[model samples]
Target: MYSRSFNIKKDLAMRNEFAKKALDANPSHPQTNYDYGLALCNEKKFDEALIYINKAIDMDPANKDRFEGFLPLLFMAMRDTENSLKWLLKMSERDSHSRYLGWLSCVYAHIDDLDKASDYLKRFLDERPEIKTLSDYRKVAPAIAKNL
Candidate 1:
């Protein structure tokens, strides 16, 4: 576990440095902005991550789907449930995948919107019936399942 943690940190440091260089070379490039934003998120720099992620979304509106997931995650990391729910709802509108439904359930549960949470959770379960247990649900949304 210690070695795994150390390796993850080392890998993220390397990726962060590479992303920084890429962003410096092309500050307005959408892909560079997205990569740098993701690297910043891995570094736990949520504010900086959101800036670049939003920039990426603005520069490439047609590819907004690519950047949507990061926004909610950064907001969640910052404990800003309103923004998280905003982005997650946008993501859900864009994609009806079980993964997004699961995220919606988790975020709604975070904000104590149990009705929405349960609705999304039911949708998620309907789409992912292979998930057979509470432990399986925990794998998707640990904190939310704990509340349920």
Candidate 2:
């Protein structure tokens, strides 16, 4: 709800405070930790966010698939292109049919690896021919298109 508010900053701050309180009250709860970590991520506190997020993942390894794809985006948000690429690669290895080929291209583009980016883009297009332009890319992966 706060994420879609008119006063986004204020709402996000309020949401973060509430999430922090919940986290403090339930330190071992995976959902609480995940919510707090997500709030911190929204505030751009990447390093701190990582601790809680990783803890939540550790506590719930059975659901790791729910976050594996998103971890690369989080690393990208932290401007850790290497880690982003590594995570994306790991995700691809884990699930070849996953919708990350385009994300791979975007990450490569961010690192100025146009050749790899083009190759990945071609692969992505082969899988998703409907995404033919920048607008389509933005709709699917805006964060990945940040560098582009």
Q: Which has the greatest lDDT? A: 2
lDDT of 1: 0.77
lDDT of 2: 0.78
RMSD to the hidden true structure, all candidates: 5.2, 3.4
Candidate 2 at 82: error in angstroms? 0.7
At residue 85, candidate 2 shows an lDDT of: 94
Q: What is the lDDT of residue 57 in candidate 2?
A: 90
| lDDT, candidate 2, at 42 | 64
lDDT of 1 by residue, 2-103 (tens): 223433566867777778888888898998888887777666787888889889999999998877766766777877889878987888787777877887
TM-scores for all predictions = 0.79, 0.80
What C-alpha lDDT, on a 0 to 100 scale, does residue 1 get in candidate 2? 24
Candidate 2 runs further than 4 Å off: 1-10, 142-148
